[model samples]
Target: LKGQIHGGVAQGLGQALMERVVYDRQSGQNLTGSFMDYSMPRADTMPDMEIFSNPVPTKRNPLGAKGAGEAGTVGALPAVVNAVLDALAPLGVKTFDMPATSERIWQAIEEARA
Candidate 1:
């Protein structure tokens, strides 16, 4: 269960911070067609996670076990994005897009200053 959640979180983090589809505008070719061109989450990029499980059995289920599938992935994207936005709130950055790359964050800061 813990491994599942961790894996999901890693996937979510990638989506939130690194995953992007790039294309060559002139040729309409997919630029990010390979792992070498595409950015993905690495071991060093992942934050230390502490997961606390509180199991609540459903009355409908005989074992009362709930599905944990995709739970981590579902929660991670918004949580990471919101956290970044919250950090930038004081800088007048009111909104930001997904895959909050370093370049994008810097752009947001510059825009806020402007």
Candidate 2:
């Protein structure tokens, strides 16, 4: 269960920071058709995760089982986005678009300076 939670969190973090698909706007053609073009987070990209859980058993389940597999992911996505935005707040970067890639962050910084 602990491992499952950690894996979920890692996946969620990857989606937030490093996962995206590129496409050509005019042709609607996929630009990231291969792994070489598409970016995914490697083990080095993941942060050290400390997973903690408080089990509350429900009578609804016969065995009193609770799911923690996706809980880490569900909460991590928006939390990470908001954290990035918060970090950029001091630079007067108020708006955040999706993916929030390095280029986007740099652009936001430049725009703020302008």
Provide the TM-score for each candidate, comma-separated.
0.80, 0.77
Per-model lDDT:
0.88, 0.82
Looking at model 1, the pairs that clash are: 57-64
lDDT of 2 by residue, 2-100 (tens): 777877787778778777888899999999999899887676777887777787888998988877767678877889989999999999998766677
Q: Please give the lDDT score for candidate 1.
A: 0.88
Specify the poorest-scoring 10-residue window by lDDT in model 1.
61-70
Cα lDDT for residue 93, model 2? 95
Lowest summed lDDT across 10 adjacent residues in model 2 is found at: 40-49
Candidate 1: tens digits of C-alpha lDDT, residues 13-103: 9999999998998999999999999999877877888998977778997887666776789988989999999999999998777789998
How many backbone clashes are present in model 2?
A: 0
Model 2 lDDT at residue 48:
83
